[model samples]
Target: MKFWRWLVILALYAVPVAVFFTVGVVVVWRSGRCWWLWWLAPLCWIAAYLLTRTWRKQLAPPAETGFVSPGHWTPRDGEAWHVVESHRRHVEDIAPGQLTDPHFYLQSAMDLALAVARHYHPKAKDPIGSLTVLDLLAAAQLAIEDSAQWCRQYVPASHLLTVDQWRTLGKTPAWLSAASNVTWAATVLMNPLNFGRYLIARFTTQAATQQLREHALGWFYLYFVSQVGFYLIEMNSGRLRGGAARYRRLQADLQRTADPPVGNEATSAAVTPEPPAEPLAVRIALVGQVKAGKSSLVNALLGRQQAAVDVLPQTKQVQQYELRVNATEDRLVLLDTAGYSDAGATPEQMREMQEAVRGADLVLLVMDAASPARRADVKLLGELSAWLEANLHRKPAPVLGVLTHLDQLRPTLEWTPPYAWREPSRPKEHNIAAAVAYTRQQFGTQLAEVVPVCTDVARGRAWGAYEELLPAMLGVLGEARACALLRTLHAELDAHRVQVLFQQLGRASTGLLRAGLAKLLDAPT
Candidate 1:
């Protein structure tokens, strides 16, 4: 029904606007009436110019509603929380075949969760989160409509809606699309041919005089200068500057967490967790799908099989080991989590995994290079990276990709070893290199580094070929030490900040309580 409504709207508005624009263009070409072109150009310039000036107030997202936001989720006795659990249930219910592509299941989980939430909860008049995401979607829909309207008249009668070139364009950001539009208009103004056309059409036509064209062209050039210059600057400095500003904003927000706003009655009644203590040692989390060889790699790194390699799914859980990597008091902690497809992980197991991920200074995303489809590893990395970026507790953990089972690459019977691991000369070595390259490319910027590992030596191979993997792991940990220290410092500072805020809240509460008591005593009955 919605689709048919869209079609009707297009037919009514789009066809006529397109025809009008087309006929105007033709008249401008033959009759030299620049008014048809220059007149609309000024209106567009004014609109875009005003958009730039009033963006802040006009584009601000509505404040979150206390009755419905995720921030307001409070448990009632026997409410079941079935909606929240529905997301995880969807993951568990995925068909065995689609389980291979974990991303598909993960996306399904989010989609199902949103659907359930929408059905159960009241709809929002205005939504939150990145304003750009919603804005771009609307702009894309509108752009297609506008394009159709302007071109309808010029287009053949039989082909009014047949051309759907606009539908094929990829999802481009609104800001980028707007900049490109300005660039197109500016190109016309700067070109030698367009300048000649503008002048000749204005002087030759009775309706569009020379003065009006000059005025229109002047504003167009001014817009070109301002809009293009701003776009160029943003192309260079936008991400870095925006990140810094957001970080500062987040810090300011965190500082105010202790003091609930005047009418936020829910937060005051809710019990808050104690501030975290400073970190004692660097924590590294080893994560992957089942049979991806995370435990075997952990054993190789530890020089002992501390983690269970082949546990049954029902009994599997997060395994922790303390390996003394250095002579000093600082002992590194390694957490080996249950694989992605591990069946029936208790709520405790899930909580343990979340805690480990939240505190991890570095993550070793183990993958089986021997496997044909490596989608699970890529999906896991993306999820963890996004989690870190969105989380306020710590900075992103540096993920080092550990590609295990290199010896099992294709031709399972074949085993080559002791080859110069650094520079590849043989087919097997080249295959390993190619596998590592592909894994790195798949993970993209999420993975800090990728190192190949053959944990168990094949029947004839002399070594497991862990030469490169060990050193890379050490380098990652060494780099992560600074990040570890930063995490500790941030924890300490955040704790102190929370402590002060709570104290102030306590005093305010106490003063109010005492004042009420005094007023009660002084008042006559």
Candidate 2:
């Protein structure tokens, strides 16, 4: 029935055109375009048919249920809000082999770090961990700038290429290169103009000019598309993937090296700091957004003003504060990470944060209860959880939400605190409960615990509800210590990988002059 219907429609549209052309109507037409007018009638009919089918296929939902798009549109949790985050936190969707690749991107990013390391002039020639705060900041900015337009990966080709002292390995197969070159050339010449370049040039001036003008649009269109196709297929097929796989070897080796030595005194100081003789020390990272009272919480945790409290962002690098307890002086080293935001951090800032997180046994993700934008904080929790699971193969690192600035909740004038939190009695308690519930709901199972606090000091409301926070942090640290070997290994391996890559880059850079001289001598002058 459908086929017959389509046949009838075609006959209704095409029959008249066939009749008119057959009867010499086109030759007798006054306007030159009049000959082509029959073509428009069938096209319009087909378009109208498609339009009618489309409208009938999509039936409207009930008016009583309100308006919505087709396919029973349903709202996704956090999807709407995710779009409003800071530009920094959002991942730029970069397509491979389109003016860039991961290798070049990594290289371009590390250039800033290299320059910063040199500027700082560290005594050690290994990894630049001893870099000053200012140096790190500058490197971070440069990394951000470079990332805006990536040039290459941070790993050197020599580092990526596996070698046995006798000779370097993994050279490209001659056949592969030959095939790619021939295929690309053939594809380029597949365009008639590209193949007929000489033939067209041989024509008389006027005739050649007219022919070239007529084919110019088709010529350029095919040329541009072919280049894009080449990047996608030929250039992408072998080298990029091979280099990336080789590079991962460096990462794996590093992860293994990052492992802290077990029962070894000399390197034990890294995880177990030497001061006041603490048998078991735990590192806790305080992570959150700017003005989320991270600094104030740090000071409160140490029972001192360790961090400067400000309206604007203040905490820059990972600052440490020691929390001592018990006769043996077991310590909780609170690593105050820069307040994070959805807007994202500079590359340097992210690196420092990762370093802190990598070593930390526990994370205190702080969020402002008064003005809650918990997306960034929640994301960090899920990421840490996933990372811990992947690395330690145990439960994810425990994350506790430290919802600060309770004083600014709703009635900004209200400073009073002591209320029935267990059984809400006032608006303040209601708001506090709501914020905690909302945060927990967003985080779901990712968050281990949530505690609300007010870290204001100027008005003597420096009341951070840290009583539960301390216990929770201590509990997580103790649990994390069970997998101390894994954490240590991860750290050591990462450090070693960085050192190796940097060393390879040094070798490559140093050999530049020799390489240039050799090339110059061999040049066909």
Candidate 3:
């Protein structure tokens, strides 16, 4: 059955090719030109096809979810991004033979992997030596899983292929390779001139084809190596797994004192000072349009009228206030930002807002229900969203929409407490619900939730400040904590990366010098 299938395939393709060759030869003979020249067109066509084809298929990053990473397992450090990008540029420059040949490919891959490992683990010449058997096995398992995922996505129904079908498919490549060798030998032996032309064409075509294959494999290894490098860095930093334990260990290390020098009892007094063990404080920024009752909300949250409340926008700068939890050190820092105008804020005001948002772990976007025009607020939200996207390595600060002036929504005479906006029965409640819905719809998924709040501090009739909004803020506390942790980690890394790198280099140079001096002393005259 296989023999018959092969015969049919050859006949189907060979007949047309033979007919075209014969017709070309006849035409060339009639024109009194060399019939061999007729093959040039086909050779050029093959070369063009090989050169024009798109070979490299893009591979996505490994699909491992970070239990602690704020932004859905994406790399949280600039160093990780740097290593991946650098490796990609280096890998793509790999020679065609190195990428296509198995032995060369493996050698090149190992060399690149070591380069990445060295960048992350600079103390060790061979970073893999530090990894245990389980670590190595885990890496292999991850690679296997990524391979399976690639097959499932790119190879379509790969799992459904029978063992016999797979074997037959595998043999197809060997048969095609043998046929190519036979064709090459036959063409070379035909005539000396033909052989020269054949060799030129074969070289051109094969070079193009090999380059395409090189690009395809280059792309595959580029993504694979990048993912491996990213995880490697994360693992080394103790951020990937056992993060809490690692954090504790880091704290312990920081608190630990160095041993005293031998025979120097006085040196024992000189110990490392323990860093202040302050709990992570969640920073919340109240941002909205001018006269959106942000100041009132701040006053209510703080249980005092500390923020100046006036008819005009009094808060010209960011005013930070601490919301301390009673009987505990756990506290939240509230940033009351200057509001944007209906037309929008000035560049300076926007800059201030951006700085406030950058430092915030959570944002409370105060929206006035009475004011239907929220274009300015929407623009601010859009800008913030873009900023967050640009900085995905940082943990995202969750935004919650606070629909303020619920009492001012409908029924001018009514001042209600405890309005059931979720399942509204009264007209005022319904209007409040509609306002919340409108806010949510306008913002889309930008807001985690919209809570209807009435921050009427001047009237002394504040509602939803403690009931709805506070609880909503506490609800996303876990997410906010993750963001805080990531924020602290990146900050610490940025501050110490250069210092640590210099220290390592200093130690390495000193050790190398010591070894050289020792060798010189031991040398015979």
lDDT comparing candidate 1 with the true structure: 0.51
Q: What is the lDDT of every predicted structure here?
A: 0.51, 0.52, 0.67
Model 1, span 1-525: residue lDDT tens: 124432442343344356548777557556655545544443333433343334423222212111231111112201213333333333223343554454764455345434433433337222212223323343334345545675675545524333364433323456665775575467576554556444432333312222223333433333322332222222121111223343333333333233322221222224432212332477888877678887777777677656666674324456778765432223568888877653333455555666777678778877888775666555555555566555423446678888888777755566766645458787777787888888777878778888777777223332442466545545555445545554655565456667867998999999999999999999999
Q: Model 1: clashing residue pairs? A: 14-149, 17-149, 18-149, 18-150, 18-151, 18-152, 18-153, 19-153
* TM, every model: 0.40, 0.40, 0.52
Q: Model 3 over residues 1-525: C-alpha lDDT tens digits?
A: 124433443353355467658776457547645665546544654545443343222221222322232232333454455655665666645665665566864665466556656655567577576554444554555566667898899995698998899879979978987897787687567544456655655665555555545655765666566666655655544343333344445434323212211221122233523323675677899988888889899988889889887766645579989986432233589999988888987898899999999988889988888888988988988887788777655656889998887767669678867888889998998898888888888989889999888878677668998788877776675566556666666677568768977998999999999999999999998
Each candidate's clash count: 8, 25, 0
Please list the residue runs of candidate 1 whose C-alpha ends up more than 4 Å from where it truly belongs after superposition. Answer: 1-280, 313-316, 326-329, 342-352, 410-416, 457-466, 493-525
How does residue 268 of candidate 3 score in lDDT? 26
* Candidate 1: residue 23 Cα off by (Å): 90
Residue-pair clash count for candidate 2 = 25
By descending TM-score, how would the candidates be arranged? 3, 1, 2
Identify the leading candidate in terms of TM-score: 3
